[model samples]
Target: MLAIRKATVADCELIHTLAWQTFPETYKDILSPEQSEYMMEWMYSLENLRKQMEEEGHIYFIAYHNDEACGYVSIQQQGENLFHLQKIYVLPSFRGVHCGSFLFHEAVRYIKEIHPTPCVMELNVNRNNKALKFYEHMGMRIVREGDFPIGNGYYMNDYIMELEID
Candidate 1:
C-alpha cells in the first residue's frame, strides 16, 4: 500500500531523485529542452530544498510505497490563509497509479489539520497541461492566470488555481 507523510530530512535524497525525473518529463513539451534542464537544476538542487525546509510556514511532503519515495510536494502558507503549493511531482513510472491525486488529497488533509481558519490552497499549472484537467476533476477551480518567472528564459504560462478548505 502507498503512504503519504510529511517528509523528513532522510527523504531529501529520494525527493531530489523524484524531482529530477518528474519535472523534466512533465515539462518536455511546455519548455525548451535547455530551459527545462536549467529550471530543474535550480529548483531541485539539494541546497535549495534544504533551505526551503527551514523557511517559516513551509510544509513539504513525500509519498512512498514500501519505503521508496514516489512523489513530493512543497507548500508555503503565505499571508492570511493561503497555502501556496510550490511544487507537486510524482515519478514518471508512477503516473496513473493515482500517486499525484493521492498527494493532492493528502495535502488538503494536512492543511485542514494545521489551519484554524478557512485555508486556501493555490498552485500554478500549465495552461495546456492534461494535469490542468486533472486538477479540475479533483475539484480545484481556476482563480486566475499568471506566469511563473523561473528565469533563464523559462517563464511558464500557467493558471493560478485554488481550492478552499473549510
Candidate 2:
C-alpha cells in the first residue's frame, strides 16, 4: 500500500529527481526542451523546495510505498478560498497505482480541514495531456485556458482547471 505524508527537507533531492523524470512526459510536447529544463531547475531546485516546504502558501508531500518515496505533490494557497496545485508526480513504475491520487487526497483533505466553507482548487495542465480528462473526471471544470509564463522564452498552452467544493 502507498502512504501519503508531509515531505521533509531531507527528501528534496529525491523529489527533484522524480519531478524531472516525470515532467518531460507532461510538458515536452507542449513546451520546448529548453523551457522545460529551465523550469525544472528553477522550480524544483533543492533551495527552492526547501523554502517552499518551509513556507505556508506552499504545501509539499511525499507518497511512500513500503517506506520508499515514489511521488510528491505541491499545493500553493492563494487566498482564503483558493489553492493551486503546483505540481504532482509519480515515478514511471508507480504511475498506474494511486500514488498521485494519494497525494492529491492529502491536498483535498487539508483544504477541507483548513477552510470552513468549501474552497477552490486549481491547476494547469498542458493542452496535449490526456490527464486533463482525468482532472475533469475528478470534477475539475475548465475555468480558463491561457499561456503560462515560465521564466525564459518557454510558454505553456494550458487549461486552467478549477474545482469548487460546496
Highest lDDT: which candidate? 1
Best candidate according to TM-score: 1
Estimate, for each residue in 3-58, the C-alpha lDDT of model 1 and write its tens digit. Answer: 98887666667778888889888988887889887877777788777777775556
Lowest lDDT 10-residue stretch of candidate 1? 49-58
CA RMSD of all predictions: 1.5, 1.7
Tens-digit lDDT string for candidate 2 (34-134)? 87778888888888888887865577788888887788888888988899998888877788777877777788887787786978999988878878877
Q: Each model's TM-score?
A: 0.92, 0.90
**lDDT on C-alpha atoms for all candidate structures:** 0.83, 0.82
- Indicate the TM-score of model 1: 0.92
Superposed model 1: Cα runs more than 4 Å off: none
- Candidate 2 ranges beyond 4 A from true positions: none
